[model samples]
Target: MNRFDTDLIIAGGGLAGATLALALARVVPSLRVTVVETFPLSADALPEHYQPSYDARSTALAWGSRLIFEELGLWPRLSEHATPIRQIHVSDRGHFGATRLNAGDHGQEALGYVADNRWMGLCLMRELLETGVQWQAPAEVVDMTPETEGVRVALKRGTETWSLSAQCLVVADGGRSGLREALGFQTRNHSYGQNALIANVSTGESHRFTAFERFTDAGPMALLPHGTTTRAGHQSALVWTLTDEALDEVLALSDPQKCQRLQERFGWRLGRFTRIGECSHYPLKLTTVDEAVRPGVALVGNAAHALHPVAGQGFNLALRGLMTLVEQLRQAVEQGQSLGDLQVLGRYQRLHRQDWQQTVQFSDSLIRIFGDAPAPVAAARDAGLVGLDLLPGAKRWFARKAMGLGGRRAVISKPGVARREPAGHE
Candidate 1:
């Protein structure tokens, strides 16, 4: 028998990595776990914490993921910062066709909830403290080499170099995953020729927990309800995907000027856009990694795929990726199979084969279908939304897919984190 350094070593302490740590800690109390993070973020959060010029913007939580968080005991804490999405309205630019999806339609209070990235991170961090994960904060994982026995990880914390070995390694460092690259995982990327402008805007009237997706010639514009925390009256977070030229205008503008441009685009539907909070921008790109696991390594989150935010699936996929791995790893352990074995990893790939493949294709085609500037294509886009609204089954399926739980479980669940409940429990 070969000796292992740690039970699990996770790189990247973002949501996926951190949440996985907590889940593993809960399921396998004796499993040794460690998280390495690169961010030099402050330990404390500012009051109201609304500010312009921030890195992470906001994210939507799918129902399936919410359940996982609820199980992990992170939802109640998150509810304080989340705004439930009671309704979602969709429309195209300069068209009369529109559709609205309500909680009543789905027989649920809301389809999902939206939270500012910072607040969500804070909530996860709280859970981490309780999870008992050994943290190596402000530490970047420089190298991860798989040995015959397990994997070795090299880290750099400021000017110091440290090493750690683990039986299995999880690479969740995101799209440009350094560890994945070092291991030679292949990735394909497609750019959207646009940049997304994200910020919080105060629209005077109450948004009533409604989310809106407005398709424009530039790209889709989304306003996710983020209940007012500032004097901005009624506030919502804005996501405007723009053409390079339009993005240039936005990037060059002063804060006040950018807010003015947004006010003109969104109109007074909510109210005049006023107070702005935390402006961030990113050029849109779509990417996918065929093999999520290599040798003794496994990948999750953006490290495996980066989706278009127009559909809000990046973090949703992150949750899905980690959940799938957790369940699989648990099962493998019980089955007496090595968690890092190719057989175990292959099962995960197979289980996610349909859902993940569909996700990438869905996001890719979704953007292309709606983003074309042609007049007829624009008409088709509106027609599609109007059609989905009128068709009960289509609308319901769409909601299910968007919620990240089409249910459809595989014949065999993946290995590595098989959790069994008490008798009469699921």
Candidate 2:
């Protein structure tokens, strides 16, 4: 038998990595876990762009994700900063078609919640500290070696070099996962020839807890409800997709000038777009790893798949997959099975395969179908929206997919109660 320093080691202390530790700590109390992070855990110690939590961006948490957070006892802190999405309005600009999805339609409290990355991180950070998981921050993973029963991780912290071993290694690093690449994982990437510009914008009329997704010639533009500004007025986080030919010109515009351009594209849905925050842009791509696990190594979050932001499904899909992974690990521990065993990791990959494939197809198809500018395509898009609105069954299906409540869900019976494991883990 081989002994390891820790039961599991999670690389990348971003949202996925940190959340994985916290979730496992709650369910698998005896398992020793450690997290390796490159950024400082202290929020005040880093700039907005550098901070893992304050990446000048916001995330739309599906209703299912909220349940996962609630089960982990992190929702109370997060809800304080989250803006509920009571309704979602989707349309195509200059088209006579639109659709609306309300929380009342599905018996959910709200369709979903929108939270800034910084505050959400703060909430997760609080829970992370309580978990007592070992943390190695301001540190980078220099190299990793996968053995028959465990993995050896090399860390470079300033002038010091440290080595650690874990029974199982989880690579939750971001899309450009250095650790994953070092471990010989293959990734397929397809560039969409588009760029996403994100920022917070103040509007003339109140957002009324409504989110908007408007399709434009440039691309899909989304404005999600954000919390109130210091002045007590409404704000919305903007995610505008544009072509590469327009990226340079758009990013070069002044705040007010950018707001004007946004108004011209988005129309008077929220009346006039007033104040705008600092803008950030990133190229769009569809990235998927060929394999999510091998023997002692398991991949999670963006390291496994990075999808287009068109449907706001990236984080939601990742969260669902994380829940499945946590459940499998808990089952392994209860059955006295090795966490690093190929059987245990292979089950997780099989369970998550369907959800992964569906989400990627949904996001990729939206980009390709909407990106083409033609009369027939425009007519088809308009008809789809109109049909979706008129058909209750179709509308419910669409709402379920958008709200992340369509598939099988992991249940949390009550606070402090161990979840019952599903059968078939032998």
Candidate 3:
């Protein structure tokens, strides 16, 4: 038998990594977990309370994700700042086709919720302070080596460097993860030849808790209802897709000029764009790794896969994958198996591969089918949108997929509850 310093070591303390740490603490209390992050994790390092910023970046949490956080007992806090997406209106610019999905029709409170990234991180960190998980932050994993028993990782904090061994290593780093490349994980990248300009815009009319997805000859754009502590009705987070040349031109325009351009593209919907906040842009691409796990290593979150934002499935998909990994780890503990056992890790990959494939296909197809289509294809898609509105079953299926409930979901037991082992394990 071999002994390891820590049962699991997670690199990256962002949303995915922190959520994984909390899940492990709840499901397998006895497992020793350590999280290494480049950012500071001390109490003094985090804000005492969240202050809404006009330009603060945000993420869309599908309905399934709300349930996951509820199980973790963090949803109550997360909800305080989250704006429910009561309805979603999708349309093709310059076409007569449009469709709407109402939460009431589906018997759900909201299809999803939009939350500020900083606030969500704060909520997770506050809860994690009470857990026994160890944290090494204001630090990073400088090097890693696969050993017979586990993985040996070297950490760098300030000018000091030290080594530690863990039975398993989980990488939750962002999309541009240097550690993943260092570990020799081959990736497939498909550049969409476009960039997304993200910002917060205020409208003359209230957003009314509605999200919008509009497609045009140039690209697809999404406007998710966003609210701040001081103002809760007229603001929305905008994700506007544009070509490389267009992106540079838009970024160079004055604030008023930018608003005018947005209004022209988006049309009279939401009245006129009254104001636009600071804007930032990133190149759009589809990045994936065929295999996200090894004997003692696993990748979660953006490190594992990064998809187009057209569907807002990036974080939601990553959350589901992490929860599934947690379920697999729980089973390994009950069976007296090594935490890094390849059989255990392989099962997690196999179970989640389907969801990954479906989501990637869904997002990619949306870009290809609707983005810069010819007259005939555009006409067909517009007609299809109208048909979708009239077909209840098809609309329902589309709604479910958008809400992140179309695939297998991992059942995570709440704190103090006994989790049943997955079936067929006997």
Candidate 4:
């Protein structure tokens, strides 16, 4: 009989979980893997919006992340729905500080890309169906026991209960992961006293594939280009941050009133904010676990570190972490080492520490520097922006970080693997 039910059991079937599964399947074709998710994974089983990853919010995929997807052969499906960002415009509102980063300056085709979260989820779900990894949805890990050899998982699905064992368990659940908490993992929390208001908007002018990040005393607001609207005008995804009171006030406003407020804040750069689709709000906080790995378990994605949306670093960082983990896991498997051994997982942890620290610190710094309204801090931040614009080398460094470059990289695909370009790319 087999020593375990599967070689790896991933809890949470979101992007990180699914991507890890796909990567593992490619690296270790013989590796047995299973994904357990609480939300409906089947398209016909639930309303489209009801999918766990179906939030209206969009993800700004760093250029490096795009490469990872391409290496995994999932980029072709995602590229169709992605909107490329050729340039980024950073400015401090009501201040004389601004900077712009262009893809051409870095010899790249795009600075980054913006993709609808719902579309990404659907694409990932479709890929999961075609993969060799086992998929179980509307299911959850009710209990897990860590041992020297492996982790035993007790999953609950509807009225049925199943017991399984895995050499390693990966937790990719979101910020409020019950399984993570149940395992007694402690987290450090920093609430920003702010909320992000997100929505799709139609602007009077074309976006021209430019992304704008304007920092105000209230908070930082971003208008990410989402390609053209049905009316042939420009459309952008709005991510506006506000304090608690302002968030409440904005949420209570009518559509036209909200548009007017957005216009006042964003100015006439994109002309007028003519229309806005359904709006959603998410509380902003930075949460990080005390440790991301145990003897038989590891944490990935938000389960490891839930970052502020500032700079759009959360998901990109998670992808980097996932890649590192997979690389380390591959080493363990090749060396015939036990996957659940702390020594094996420890290597993975050590390799990922720098990347995690740098990303977390970078994200937190942006939130601290821009989310506050203190006079001295605001002035200093504005001057910093001015300095960044003046220094080409510094600007390139910042852009590279934003593009998810630097640091140690994991091998995503075979050295000479080629991929198909998605439709709509110029």
Each candidate's TM vs. the true structure?
Answer: 0.89, 0.92, 0.96, 0.92
Query: What digit string (tens of lDDT, one per residue) describes model 1 on residues 181-231?
Result: 877889888888888888777766888888888876667899888754322
State in Å the error of residue 284, model 3: 0.5
Whole-model lDDT, candidate 2? 0.83
Over 4 Å off, model 2 = 43-56, 229-233, 412-426
Per-prediction tally of clashes: 14, 0, 0, 0
Candidate 3 lDDT for residue 254: 94
Per-residue lDDT tens digits of candidate 2, residues 1-426?
A: 438888898988889988888888887777899999988777563333422232357899988788788778898877876788888999888888799999987777788898878777667777777776999997987777877678888888899998898878899988889888888889999998889988888899989889999888888999998874222236888899988878788888887898899999999989899888878889999999878899888999999999989888889898888888887888888788889888999988888888889888877887777775689988988899999999999998888888887655555333367556332111
Clashing pairs in 4: none
Flag clash pairs in model 3: none
Strongest candidate by lDDT = 3
**Which ten-residue region of model 3 has the weakest summed lDDT?**
417-426
| Count of backbone collisions in candidate 3 | 0
Distance from true position, residue 163, model 2, in Å? 1.1
lDDT of 2 at 248: 85
Give per-residue lDDT, candidate 2, residue 170.
Answer: 91
After best superposition, candidate 1 residue 75: deviation in angstroms?
A: 1.2
Whose TM-score is higher: candidate 1's or candidate 4's?
4
The whole-model lDDT of each prediction reads 0.75, 0.83, 0.89, 0.82
Please report the TM-score between candidate 2 and the true structure.
0.92
